[model samples]
Target: MEIAQNYLDSIRFEFERYKTMGDATFAQLDDSDILWRYNDLDNSISQIVKHLSGNMLSRWTNFLTEDGEKPWRHRDTEFEDPFTTKAAMIAAWEKGWQCLFEALSLVNPDNFDTVIKIRNEDHTLVAAFNRQLAHYAGHVGQIVLMGKMIKGEKWVSLSIPKGQSEAFNTKKFNK
Candidate 1:
C-alpha cells in the first residue's frame, strides 16, 4: 500500500515537471512560433497540444469506469489546429493536465491495480501512468526543442546550458 501511494506521488511529480517544461517552452515562443512546423508532414506545437488535450480528456474522464479511447474522440481531427491563438492552445493544454491530475487524485491503494482500458486494451493503473508519462515527456521534449530552434541563440536554457555541465556539477557538489 505504501508502494502504491509512493508511486502515485512520484508520477504526479513527473507529470508536473513535464508540464513545467512545456510552459517554459511556450513562454519563450511567440504566437506564430507555436504554429511553425518543419513542413506540411510535421506537427506544429499547437496541433500537438490539441492532440494531447483530446487524448487526456478521453483517457482520464471516468478512467476507472470507461475506455480511455472515448467514443466521441476524433483522433485524426486532433491533428488539425482549431486554435487560432496561443492563449487558446495553452488553455487546452491546461485543461488536459487538469483532467489528468484530477483523475489521478481519485486513485488510491485500494484501486492501484485496477485494470484500465485504452482502445479496449487492458492496462494496469501503473502501466497507464507510465504510458502517459512517456507520451507527454516525448511531446514536451519536442516543444522545447522546437522552441530552441525557433529562438536560436536567444533561447534560454531550461537546464544546465550547453558546455556548462561541469560548472553546474561543481556548483552542486560544493553546496
Candidate 2:
C-alpha cells in the first residue's frame, strides 16, 4: 500500500512539474506568439495546447471507467486553432488538467491494480499514467521549444541557464 501511494505521489509530482513548465512558457508568450507557426507543416503553440487539452479531457474524464480515446473526441480538429485569445486557451488547458487531477484523486492503493482501457487496449493504472505522462511531457517540450524560438534571446531559462550550469552545481553542492 505504501509503495502504491508513493508511486502515485511521484507520478503526480512529475505531472505537476511538467504542467508548471508549460505554464511558465505560456507566461513568456504573447497572444500572437502562441499562434505563430514556422510553416504549414508545423503546429503553433495554441494548436498544441488544444490537442493536449483535448487528449487530457478524453483520457482522464471517466478514466477508470471508459476508454481513454472517447468516441466523441475529434482528434484531427485539435490541431486546428480554435482559441482567439490566450486566456481562453489557458482556460481550456486548466480545465483539462483539472479533469486529470480529479480523476487521479479517485485512485487509491486498493484500486491501484485496476485495468485502464485506451482504444480497447488494456493498461494497468501505472502503465496508463506512465503513457500519458510521456505524452504530456513531449508536448510540453514542444511548447517550451517554441517559446524559446519565439522569444529568442529574451527567453527565460526554465532550468539552469545556458552557461550557468557550473554555478548552479556549485550552489547545489555547497548546500
Candidate 3:
C-alpha cells in the first residue's frame, strides 16, 4: 500500500512543532533554571531533556529492525544529572531529535503496516509512530510548562497569549 505524502508530511510537521516548543522553552530559561530541581522528588528541565534525547535515539534508530528499549539504553541514567550546562543539554536534545528525524525520513507508506516491537510488544508501523508521537508531545508539554513556571511573567508565549484570543481571531478572520 502506498503511504500518502500528506500523512507523512503532517507527522513531520507535528514533530517539528514539538521540537520548536522545546527550543522556545529552553530559550526562556537561564542555565541555572534549567538545572534547578524543585526538590528531591522532581526532575529538572535538564534531566527531562536528557531523558527525551535518550528515548528519541533509542526508539527511532533502527526502529523497525530492533526493539525500542535498546539493551544499551540506560534509562535510569537519563533521570540523573548527566549534564552540568544548558549547552550540553541542548546539544543532547538536538542529537536525539536528529536521529529521530532521520529514522522517520526512512519510513514510507509501504512500511506503515510492517510490525515493530516496543519492549517486546508488537505494533504496526502506523500504531508505533502514533504512540511515540504522543509520548514526545507529552514530554515536550512538560518541558514547556516547567519553563513557563520558572520564568513566570518573563516567559514568552509559545502560541497565542492569554486574553488575546479575540484579537487573534479577529486577525485570522480579517485574513
Query: For each candidate, how many residue pairs have backbone atoms clashing (under 3 Å)?
Result: 0, 0, 1
Lowest lDDT 10-residue stretch of candidate 3: 1-10
Each prediction's Cα lDDT score? 0.94, 0.94, 0.88
Q: What is the total number of backbone clashes in candidate 1?
A: 0
lDDT by residue for model 1 (1-175), tens = 9999999999999999999999999999878999999898999999999999998999999999999999999999999855768899999999999999999999999989899899999999999999999999999899898889889999999999989999999999999
How do the predictions measure up, each by TM-score? 0.97, 0.97, 0.94
| Model 3: residues with Cα > 4 Å off, grouped in runs | 1-3
lDDT of 3 by residue, 74-167 (tens): 9999998658888999999999999989988888876666788899999876777789899999999988988888988998999999999999
Ranking by TM-score: 2, 1, 3
- Cα error of candidate 3 at position 161, Å: 0.6
For lDDT, candidate 1 versus 2, the one ahead is: 2
For candidate 1, report its TM-score. Answer: 0.97
Task: Tell me how candidate 2 scores on lDDT.
Answer: 0.94
Model 1 RMSD in Å is 1.0
